[model samples]
Target: MKRYTKLGLILTIIVTCFYVTTASAQGHYNVLKYGAKNDSSKLATESIKKAIAAASKAGGGTVYFPAGKYLTGPIHLKSNITIYIEAGAEIHFSDNFDHYLPMVKSRWEGTDVMNFSPLFYAINAENIAIKGRGLIDGHGKKWWAYSEVHVKKIPTSRWQEEFKRLNKDVLAPDLPGWIERGFLRPPFIQTMDCKNVLIEGITITNSPFWTINPQYCDNVTISKVTINNPDSPNSDGINPESCRNVHISDCHISTGDDCITIKSGKDRSGRKANVPAENYTITNCTMLSGHGGVVIGSEMSAGVRRVTISNCVFDGTDRGLRIKSARGRGGVVEDIRVNNVIMRNIRDQAIVLDLQYATTTVEPVSERTPAFRNIHFSNITAHGNRAGYLNGLEEMPIENVSFNNMNMDMQTGFRIKNSKDIEFHNVRVNNKKGPVVEAENVVGLQIDDVRSQKPVAGEAIIELTNVEGAIIQNAFPAKGTEVYLKAKGAKTSDIVGKANHFGNVKTVVIQEADVKEKIKLD
Candidate 1:
């Protein structure tokens, strides 16, 4: 009798432990349990918040929403939690402007300010994720309509009045005057100062502003996501600002603005933060109908470096592989490498490096001077492009840019200005205009095995002005070309050529009256 009693006690203990382990493993806090009604008419804001709080208090677990439509406002995420919307579930953000009240710390167009909170926000959290094959609708029509009425193209008189009001309300606002007084919209999903974040397998639509924006975060992975916002203004697909160690892969983005823009900050505010968006790897992404395929910034004031983009396809984009910044935005963008990129139906330049992006006047060389260097492009093929423009600033010229194995079919060929240490190897452009290659104010230029096809007027195939230390070797111009090389400038010297075939003509024109020394040709 004593032995049987001891065996029974052991069995009871084993059964109790099994139940505990099972409960721990399946710790899913359903929103329905927290008074969240699945009816589309009801607002599930408080219930969802309760669910998140309960799960967080219980050492973190999944906040699950079953197959139904849950309408809410501004879902805030916490640490050590995962919000999983099951298949056929949808989270629709309400259009109530008052619901996003009590502004939070956020960035609007690269400037830090206290604004309306993002649709989904998180701060100072770790190991947070929003995953599942569901849908997130931002209900952005109201925001878009509001911006059109108040923000876009305000009258000059109204602008002055608004500026006065902004200065009076907020002391020294950094953003534009039009966007100062509650005109700037919030992003769809924003996480600041968070770590170990994962956003995967979700279809997002109609964002109020930028779709996925992560600022000052680390170890972020965004994969298998689809963003479809075709007509909303400023609806950028994914923008990573002041973040590090990010990976964006296998995303299909078709937005109204830039597909993917990497930035740090904008102006003085950006320089004060002193954090750069670096160490990013973007691969196997499809960009469609955006401003640019993969843009660096018009707002990168806090130096961006060490980014690699490969195996991407850009169709019907305005520009491909663009980097733009103005004078007052002081940053150094370097070590950017792109390979195996194919572009079609490009509306503007296939590749652009414009240091004079927005501002027209030149400023003194200081910490605010923008610089681009050490950028390399290889194995790129572009068709139906207008031109390839590489215009740098006179004060701070673009340096150390290389292009290899490029085949372009465009209306005009390359127009390089105010650059140094440029090289083009095995490059071909079937341009439709004369003067296929034009270079001005260049230093240390080299063109190897470069060819152009069928000039219309037999004009000079390559035109050089104010260039120094130029080497042209193994260049084959088209037949009926008037001049193989036309060199003219006071500073043009050391122009050398070897093994070049000047088809049907061998005329080299050098205006050497004001040249410092005679040009050397071999």
Candidate 2:
């Protein structure tokens, strides 16, 4: 080893520090250095792909984009590659649809198809990441113009015949024409059949459709990402389909559709695949201007389970914490727990669990019947149009759902229909319209410390129709309560109330004279 002088060593140390701090260091392949134009004038698609090839050939390195605007088409990511965009750097994806040519295999809207490639795509890869304090713009104005709202038939919908190969048991007749109808928009960043994926610290905007979609992926973590896509059609922020071990935190999402959606697959294909989207933990997220804050299904056919959502705030979303599935989608949504969530300015119900989401036809219990059960919500506060809506199926009613310590101030109250084994503890709904709890065709309903703070005069505080067994205890009712409880319908029976202070209630219980034997206070 040769000895160095003090001055030379100091200079060498400073240079080493600078090189280590730079994003385009020796181990990193810089896009600009690989003939990628930094200006947005030229297409850098080939150069960026070349840089990724270099990095991947070198046994995995970072492909760096440093402090400039890069115009590129589709970016295909390989395994063991990291795309790092430094601060002040932006990647503008081309709007020309031809750039995404050759029609890669992609799962569009819970159906597998060979459609347009995503802006950034990967398949069957592992240990991939796209993380930096930078921006990835899809430049989706041209794509949005292809929507059916403006154009009747989009060019992307030409793959209808191809979709039939993957899934022939299509329930929706319009599934094939979805692309032509401009219903299936390509995702911004999509990874399929991959593992150990991460997307962090990036700001994504102007996505064509679902921004970050991961299909058949595992060990995915998306954190500290800011996604804003306002007034754009089908621009869901993040959708993880048939994925497991997903962790999403510290994200701020405001999209036209759902902020975060979980899907498995579509009807029979999903069941045939038998891959459930499970083991998800979503916490510390802020959602605004989206259709739903955290939505599940409307596409779950393989089943969705073991999901935990905590410490999330939803503002200006149409609905918050929703789970909806329709008939012909044979799946079970169970073992879901939500805690410490706040919702305000919700256009629809704060929490909704509906089995009749996209279909209206009633079918018999079979492999095509969807079910919702074993869901629990606690420590939730909301100010919305309605507190909650739980509408189950006539054949298979929702089962074993409980809500505890929920406080809400809404224009309307909670609506529960076609459910069983439901419990509400320490729940308060302050609404201006209708009854606090309007439950119909319910069996085994339990209300403990539950009441309407502002009960309407004419409408009963709690209306029960065709209810089999209802037990109310430890209730806290405010003054000017006109009717504490009302029971009706031919099947209504076994209304029990105990341990309640009823000094302010004008009427304790009201029973229809015709069904007096069927409905009475015990």
Best by TM-score: 2
Q: Write the per-residue lDDT of candidate 2 for residues 221-264, one digit (tens) a residue.
A: 99999999989988999999999999999999999889999999
Candidate 1 worst ten-residue window by lDDT: 166-175
lDDT of 1 by residue, 1-522 (tens): 999999999999999999978866857889999988777778998999999998899878888889899999999999988988888889999988678866777787777766777999999999898888889999998878656443555334443353344434332223354353445678999999999999998889999989999999999999989999997788999999989999999999999889999999887778888899899999999999899999998888898999999999999989989999888888899999999999999998889999988756877899889899999999999986655778899999999999899988888888899999999999888888756678999999998877776664656777888999899888876676667677788888888888876655557554546667665455
**Number of clashing pairs, model 2?**
1
The residue pairs found clashing in candidate 2 are 157-180
Off by over 4 Å in 2: 1-26, 149-183, 514-522
Query: In model 1, what are the clashing residue pairs, if there are any?
Result: none
Model 1 regions more than 4 Å off:
1-26, 148-182, 504-522
For model 1 the local lDDT of residue 104 reads 79
lDDT of 2 at 266: 81
